[model samples]
Target: MNLQTIGNAILIVLVIGWIGYRQTTWRPVAIGRMYRLALILAIVGAGLLVQQSHGLTGLDVAVLLVEIVISLGVGAWMGAIARFRPLDPPVRVGSSDQVARFASRTGWWGLALWLVVLAVRVGIDVLATSLGAHAATSTGIILLLIAANRVARTAVFAVRLERHAAVTA
Candidate 1:
């Protein structure tokens, strides 16, 4: 199998193991694992476009490095935002006042981060294309869309999962 397949497999296992462990002995450690997986995914995703057509110039290389840093920084920020007191077996349902406040803060920050990333990408694209310097590499837009989608989905999924747990309780 290819490296991509191997990496994907490992990631899936990590996620499953984290969820299972979270239900058992060490929820905090499982949360840590989930954040680690996010970081790993961000790094892997930053390099999704590798081809002759997407060859990086010196400026493009610098931009890519910056993007990687930003991506990891965002991942760290998300992990921090997600940190909360452990839930008891009798799962709490709906939006707790505490959770609502957390969501507002977290959601605003997450939105701001994505906006900054998008702005940087657009700025770079304008600079590169305008100067006719390096127009080959073009993964930024697609990755930005994907990151936005994933972040939104994560928030929604977390809420839904909490609701389901509450119902089952």
Candidate 2:
């Protein structure tokens, strides 16, 4: 593999490690932070998509769509299974002192779901490679898929947190 491939592999491992740590630990839910992360990932992924778009084929697009669906589905599933508890003294969010925060963790289930996603992603990549769809293997496309997944999870968390706040308020 070339340096770029090695770099991508390292980046994926680091991201997975970071995500795993976050999902298993009780952390304050900052909706703004989550959205910002999703946005950043999306922008970077979009840049990669543009750089690689010239070589895409119909099959690549189809495989990409499939991956996106799977990513979003798994992310939503992870979010739905996450456990949330209210913070003792509502934490301040941003510059507004009026915000209440909660702590959330997916625990072991989140890790398991992450493994499932990785397995499925690898499986799909192998299948797509056999079918000659290069996009399936592009790190940029992978990032985009991840971005989409994050957005789904963030949306679920936002909604659930809202409901939780209303009930606790």
Q: What lDDT does each candidate get?
A: 0.46, 0.84
Clashing residue pairs in candidate 2 (N, C-alpha, C atoms within 3 angstroms): none
C-alpha TM-scores of all predictions: 0.43, 0.90
Cα deviation in Å at residue 152, candidate 1?
18
Instruction: Report the C-alpha lDDT of model 1 over 1-169, residue by residue, as the tens digit.
Output: 5564365346435643443343333232232233344445445555565532356577666655555556556544644454344444433334332222112123445555555645665566567667664532344323433354344435443664466558767
- For model 2, residues 25-94, the per-residue Cα lDDT tens digits are 9988887777787889889987887786677899998998998899899889888999998788878767
Q: How many clashes (backbone N, Cα, C below 3 Å) per candidate?
A: 0, 0
Error of 2 at 49 (Å): 1.9
State the lDDT at 93 in candidate 2: 69
Candidate 1: segments with Cα more than 4 A from true spot? 1-47, 52-54, 78-83, 90-105, 133-137, 140-169
* Candidate 1 overall lDDT versus native: 0.46
